[model samples]
Every structure is written in C-alpha cells, then in structure tokens.
Target: MPNKNTHYKVKNLHGTSKDRYSKKKCECDNWLAHWRNNTKSQRTTCAVLECARKATVGAHVICVDGRMSNEWYIVPFCKYHNHYEKKDEYFLDSRVHLIPVYKLDGCKRG
Candidate 1:
C-alpha cells in the first residue's frame, strides 16, 4: 500500500527492446503474476499517479533517478500506459510497489 510520502520516479523503457523479454518465463508465469506474487497485493488500477483504468499488464520501467538505471522494475499498468514511449516519464503513486523484473542470479521466481 502507498505511504503517501514515497513517490517513485520511473520512465518507460524502449518499447522495442522491452518486447524481447516478453517470452521469458518466471515462476509466477508472467510478469503481472510475478508482481502479484512478490508484492502480496492484488492488481487494481494502473500504477501511474492519476490513471483510473484497470491494470492489465506488468509494464517494464527503469528508475529515472540514475541509481537503478540499469535495472528494470515491473509495475502494474493499463494497456494504454504500457505503450508509452521510452522518453515518457511519470511519477508512480506512492502505494504502487515495484517488483524487480530480474534477479542478479537469474529470473525472479515466486
């Protein structure tokens, strides 16, 4: 749940390269499932601050603050927001939890 004081700064990764990871399998089946299993929360609306649409995909994003620029994180997103261009940046709601898309050892397992 959001703490109301911890907004996450994120940017969509390049769509073309992001698609390449679509077929990879994790213990939870898909990225969305991975997010759910890891966060211990149910998917509701898109993670974007004001988006009201139901979340349908686990969109890949990278932190824009440079600390984790090389790592990808997954957050729930609607079909529309999931297609944002790489240059698009947004502040995710404080309640939204980011799940690491990959592990240093291997793909993240549930």
Candidate 2:
C-alpha cells in the first residue's frame, strides 16, 4: 500500500500502439483481471485523482517521470476517462496498483 500523500504521474497510452498489442494475453485473461490479481485488491472507482466514476476498464498508461518509460502499466479507469482524446497527463492515486503488461514482469500464473 502507498501513502495517502503520494501520487504517480502517468500518461494514457491507449491507441498509441496502433493495436499492435491488442492480441497480447496474460494469465489472468485481461489487463483488468491482471491488475486485480496482482494488486490483491478490487477497485470500485477510477484511479485518476479526483475522479469518482466507476471503473470499467484497465487503461494502458506510461510513467511520465522517465521511470520505466518503456514499460506499459495497467490502471483502473472509467469508460469516459479511458478514451484516447483525453491525452493529458494525470496523477494516479498512490494506492492504485500498476500492473505490468508483460508476462515476464510476474503477471503470469505458473
């Protein structure tokens, strides 16, 4: 768990990959499931700070601070907030767990 005062800067990377990784699969079936499994917790609200909407999808985002920029992370997001048009960077709640998309990052169940 993260401290309540902490926040992580992240940028939505949806639609940026041209669907290249759309077919990629993890042991948990979907990115949202992967996130839930890895985090060991369930979220009812969006991960974006100040957003109280219900979370409906696992959004792909990248850390904007250059920490593991090449890696993609999964965060819970509402349908409206998950769209590509909302490209502005936002701060995620510190308690939200970022699940890695890659299987080798320990998202695999074996």
Candidate 3:
C-alpha cells in the first residue's frame, strides 16, 4: 500500500511535443514563486465534487472553443485527478466531471 504521507511529483511528459519545462529557468521555481508569493490561501481540496484529498497542484484548464477567448483556468487538484483528468481515455470507464475556466483574470496569456 502506498503511504499517505508520500508526496507525489508531477513529471514532465516524455517524448511529447509539449514544452513542460523551460530551458532558461526551473519550472518548479516559477511555480514555487507563484505558490509562495501569493497572498491568497491555497486550496486544500481537489475541486472535483466529493473528493476530499488535499490539492497538491494547480491544474490549468485550457479553453476548447475559439469563441471562449483564449483563457486558461487554474484549479486545485489532487495527484490522481490531475494526472488522468486530461486523458480522454479515462472517461471510457469513468464519469469524470470537468470544470470550465472562462477568464484569465489576473494571469497573463502566453
């Protein structure tokens, strides 16, 4: 059995075209800076309904429609949901609920 105290680390997807990391700076450093410098309280639970585990990461939801106006929504998520939530195949045997993000608000568009 997995220890409850074990913290999960998000790994950069291998052999993929996505740039999960930056060559100029550490992604974790940037995330930590954002995580620490913020005055708002961090979310303590996964945003998925009924999930009670602590949110270990901020999962960004990309806008699927062009009409939505290029927006990236970020939500608190646990390791399991954050990992499989984006993979469409996970829905084949599961009823996953996706929360939509509509505006960037204070965040900048890249």
RMSD of each: 4.2, 3.7, 11.1
What does candidate 2's lDDT look like per residue over 1-110, in tens digits? Answer: 33224777788886843567755666766767777877877788999988999998788898876555568888898888888788888888878877877664446575
9-84 per-residue lDDT for model 1 (tens digits): 8887656235577755566667777787778788589999889999988888887755454678889888888875
Over 4 Å off, model 1: 1-5, 16-20, 23-25, 67-69, 84-86, 103-110
Error of 2 at 94 (Å): 1.2
> In every candidate, how many clashes are there?
1, 0, 0
Score every model by TM-score.
0.76, 0.80, 0.41
Candidate lDDT values, in order: 0.74, 0.77, 0.38
Pick out the ten consecutive residues of candidate 3 with the lowest summed lDDT. Answer: 88-97
Error of 1 at 45 (Å): 0.5
- For candidate 2, the 10 contiguous residues with the lowest summed lDDT are 1-10
Model 1 whole-model lDDT (C-alpha atoms): 0.74
Evaluation by lDDT, superior candidate among 2 and 3: 2
Q: Please report, as a residue range, the 10-residue window in candidate 1 with the lowest summed lDDT.
A: 101-110
